[model samples]
Target: MKYYSTNGQVAPVSLEEAVVKGLAGDKGLFMPEKIATLSKSTIDGLKDKSFREIACTVARAFFGEDIEPDTLDALVKDTLSFETPVVPVRKNCYSLELFHGPTLAFKDVGGRFMARLLGYFIKKQGLNDVNVLVATSGDTGSAVANGFLGVPGIRVFVLYPKGKVSPIQECQFTTLGQNITALEVDGTFDDCQALVKNAFMDETLNNHMALTSANSINVARFLPQSFYYFNAYAQLDRMGKAGEMVVCVPSGNFGNITAGLFAARMGLPIKRFVAANNRNDVFLEYLNTGKYTPRPSVSTIANAMDVGDPSNFARILDLFKANEDVHKAICSKISAYRYTDEQIAQTMQTVYSETGYILDPHGACGYQGLIDSKLTATETGVFLETAHPAKFKETVDKILSSDIEIPAKLQAFMKGTKQSVELDKDFVGFKAFLLRQ
Candidate 1:
């Protein structure tokens, strides 16, 4: 319904305002003013429902108060056109295959949902045009690009680090030429993220263009991610394995895992969570030392989770209150693990060899986290395989020593010529470019 800024310096606003103005004026992420819990009967009902049905139910809980019931239903229906199946990867371990969407990544649901929701708000307000600024390490760019592709009043600008993303990941966004523009920033993911944030705070840019973020900072972008978590639980419930479930998420900007925490708050019956990281272990370090230290991200095989300063960490702090309490609560329900590129490669190879399950580098981090954490026999581990393996064709091929078939969806993306603007990591240059547009 209503949303409050995590920084607490700004007044609460409606869902429409939060969706349109991504970052608060005080530079804080917007959070729901209240979390609504589901009745046990309602959670029980999800066991027999389709993914869309479950999603509509969950979406209504978060959005029904503000959006019309019929409109929210249609939004959930269109956004979740694809399924995220839970497939077995090992004994007592399941991989929540979230890469089945058009972009073949977990962000598809969020991106598509936000696109439709934002489009609705813009049309309702009769705005001429709205600009969406997103910074992606990998999957997010493509997801957002395609999600908003040709939507009537929205233009999406996806900013990503030059040469850091996988070839397929880069192609997926850069090649799409209508209403979607890719900015190849000559810096890390953090730099691209900073440019987006700085653009949102710039008075000239905001006055010139209605700039909003499609990154996890936007409530519309991240809240819909809760859909898959509820759907994951429903699937586990169907198999009678939902009793003791540990969900492992390959976290980058921490948005995916943060969504799971929100689901848990809404009575999702999750026993605990594991945040799997690759090289960029700032959150892991925080769990170990109770200190939040962010540095420049290091390039790794799992490039998507290569975020050094996750913006959603603020939401986690707001959810749990004081840092000490946040630390305690997070440590209690969530255990974090970090792995290197070598470990990710080894895990990918081993899982394919043993289970015949091909894992992308990002998913490998999640699989390794479950192995390293040692789930009890009574606990069923479900790791979010965030992206399709084919998206990292070269890396997967090298590790497996076999060619992985690219899906028709991805093969089509590769055929389009990449069309992206190169920019230095400076905000002024980025600002001038936007002002020119």
Candidate 2:
């Protein structure tokens, strides 16, 4: 498959090129030239396929002859080494538990897939000395750092807001030494993201070094996330509990829900989806009004979604701008809402009281969105639990007055080494770091 820039000014690129380049030369997220639809039979048959097999089928359909079948299979095997189960927490609300991966966060799916795919492409084409630039609110830096760590011929530089991320989240990224390095920027996620984008858009930087992205803005980082929507549907179908489902996704850069929009386009039987956000509720306003206006990001407890101007909104608009049919297909099945830290904490308390489920602040935001929407019981609600509760152990412990066990994967991470730099969240500091690299 080939991809072109949304602005129609860039050369079309092969799948490998798109994965490696991340953004088009004209500064657009590389969208698939075509989105393939899954037949009804294919959707029905998905129930029987293992997560790896289904992922292989979906990825192979897009990758085609570019990636060998065995290679894709092995990539899926290594990436999805754990399960993404939809655990029930209430009569209709389900937690689409995505922390089952190595990093105990949903970004693990995209991060791992993108790293290996980039690795595959680089190895196949004999490309070397690539640099991956990424921005993180909280979980993304750790996930990307861990995902691309020690991969030959590639170096990962993760920039995160200095004091915003949780201590564990910061440690997870900074501790992974190898080819991974973290930059603690004295600014918000938007600042980090801006610096990363500026580096990519810089002509001098492009000439001196090959730069790519690991943010959800990257098509490679977004596509694999579609797998869990299918996985959730299949799980519900197998248990004879399938219904018109509304998935509440904690939206930051909007890539997660955009992935779901891609799946629904492929004929998944989803009723609607909620793009839940924290204080950075730019998307929430857009869904309510047709106009999209961005503001500065605000810090909140659900730190991951603290994005004021989401980069992936461009991709979302591109998906909908094709035709009326495409627009209806995507917009009809989507909605958006925002929550505050107080609301998130209250919902976390309510869920723990009612369901004995301790949600991290992010998951609590998703749950709150579903409740605020008053989704019907028949319309099952599944909140995307993007990270482990233990990642926010202080809040979780305070709310429930109990300890949440850290998963084995995180335990292993705690044992590994880390490397990082402290820098002011300024373009000069970021540019200096790039020049050194």
Candidate 3:
């Protein structure tokens, strides 16, 4: 399938080009030329399929034309080595646990899928090393670093705000030495994102070495996230609770929810969506006022959702076309909710005390969205548990006044020494560093 840039200056290009280039020449996010809806029979078929099988079906719909069937199937299978279970949290609310993967975050599915797809393109074109630049608030750095670690023909640079990410989240990426590098920017997540975007747009940097983003801005990275929404629906379908299902996602850069919007467009049978936000509630403000205003992001316990200017909002606008229509559609199918740090902490503690379910700060925001929105008796709510609680042990432990055990996977990450370079969040400094590399 062909892809077009949201800016509309660049002509439509093949899927391979879109994936490789990441950002279009016009500095716009790439979007599919057309979204194909799945047949009702196909959606029903997913009920009996395994997570891998269902993911493969969804991947085939978007990527089959670009990748061989066998190759795409293998990629999907490898990326989803672990299952995203829909666990019961309350009477009608469920948590889609997405922290079962290597990095223990929802971004694993997208990061791994992008790594394999990029590897395929690199091998096919006989290209040299490609540098993947990603800006992360928390989980994304770890997810992308571990996902692309040791993969041939690709090197990953994870740029994150210094002292903002959790200790475990930082270690997961910084400790991995081979083919993975971390840059600790002396700014917020938005600064790191700006540096990455500037690097991609710079003629000197682009000419010096191959640079592409692995952030949600990349079509390859964000599109695969739809697999989670599909799998969640499949699980609910099996349980006979698929009717009037509302999927709530913790909104950050908006990539995850954008993917879900794509799924709904492709007939996922979702009744509506809920965008859960923290203090950095630019999207929430838009939902309330119907005006798009972006400012500096404020720090919150849910660090990942602290994106003042989400890169994928452009893709969302493009998806809906007109501004009024976009507002109406989003308002109709999605409810916007924002929570403060206190509320997130309280919800985390409350959910644990009531359900014995530990939620990371990010997931707490999602759960709170459901509670604040007040799901109807007939409506079943599924909120995405985006990360393992252990990732934010210090905060969660303090909130619950109990020591949370670190999973074996996270403990392993702590054993390695962090190896990250400190850099200022300036385009000139970032560009010079890339040239030196």
Candidate 4:
């Protein structure tokens, strides 16, 4: 399938080009020139299929004949080694456990899928090396690092704000050596994102290395994330609870919830979507006022969702036709709610006391969003638990008055020492560091 830029200035590109180039030359996110809507028959067939089979069908519809059938099958197999189960958290609330992957976060699915696809494309083009650039608040760095680690013909560079992410989140990225390198930017996530975007548009950097991205802005990252919505539905259906349900997503860059909306467009029986947010509530304000505005991000306990200006808002606009009237209808189906750090802590404690579910600060924000959105009556509301509670151990412990044991995977990570250089939030300084490296 061919992809086009949002601005209508750039020429269309093949799936190969879209996957490799990431952002279009016009500096817009790449979107399919045409979207293949799921037929009734396709949606009906998905009910009985395995998660892997369903993913293959959904992915193949958009991918067309771009990837080899066997290669795509193998990639799907490797990508879904862990299960994404929707478990009961309360009488009317469910929790989508998306932290089962290697990095223990929702980004794992996208990261693994992108890494494998990049590997396939590099092999096809006979290219020996490439650079993958990513900007992260928390989980994204580790997910991308682990996903691309030691993959032949690729080096992955992850940029994250220093002193913003959780301790475990930091370790998850810095501890990974080999093909993975982490950059600690002494700025907000917006700064890291800006630098990455500027680097992609830089003529010198583009000439020095073949630059790509693993952030949600990439089609690769955006597409694989649709699988969880499928898995959530399948799990609910298997439990004989297949009615229309609300999904509360703790949104940061808004990619995860947008992926869910994309699946709904593909015929998932979603009743509504709730964008659960922390201090950064641009989408929240947009949902309430129908006016898109920019603001500075406020640091919160749920640091990952602290995005004042989400890049994926472009895709959200494209989904709703970029018209205020159309967005009103879309907002009817999507409700946004922002929570405070105190509320998140209270919700975390309450869930631990009542349901025995230990939610990280981010998940607590999602839980609180559902309550604030007045979805307590909805029996099928599923709040996305994007990370393991241990990732934010200090916050979780202080809130719940309990200690979380580090998982074996995280324990192993402690053995690998961190290697990173602190950098000022300046493009010139960052560019110099990249040059020296």
Question: Candidate 1 — number of clashing residue pairs?
Answer: 0
Task: Give the alpha carbon lDDT tens digit for every residue of 251-320 in model 4.
Answer: 9999999899888887888888999888788888887887889777778999998788899998888888
Would you list the C-alpha lDDT of every candidate in the order shown?
0.93, 0.85, 0.92, 0.86
In the range 220-260, model 3's lDDT, one tens digit per residue, is: 99999999998999999999999888988999999999999
Candidate 4 at residue 265, lDDT? Answer: 83
State in Å the error of residue 128, model 4. 1.3
How well does candidate 1 match the true structure in TM-score terms?
Answer: 0.99
Candidates, ranked, TM-score: 1, 3, 4, 2
Q: Please say which candidate is ahead in lDDT: 3 or 4.
A: 3
- Per-residue error at 360 for model 1, in Å? 0.5
Segments in model 2 whose C-alpha atoms lie over 4 Å from true places: 324-331, 415-418
- Which pairs of residues collide in candidate 3? none
Off by over 4 Å in 4: 322-324, 376-379
Residue 148 lDDT, candidate 4, scale 0-100: 94
Model 2 lDDT-worst window of ten: 322-331
- Which portions of model 3 show Cα errors greater than 4 Å? 322-324
Model 2 C-alpha lDDT per residue in residues 1-437, reported as the tens digit of each score? 78888777888898888888888888878888888888889888888988888888787766665778888888877888888998998778789999987778999989998999899888887988999999999998888888998999999999999889887787788887779888888899999998988888888788889999999878889989999999998888887666687889999988898899888877888888888888888776876666689988998888888999998888888888857665454457677777888888888888898888889999998888887778875788888999999887877888778888877767776675656788887787778778877
TM-score of each: 0.99, 0.96, 0.98, 0.96
Give candidate 1 regions above 4 Å deviation. Answer: 322-324
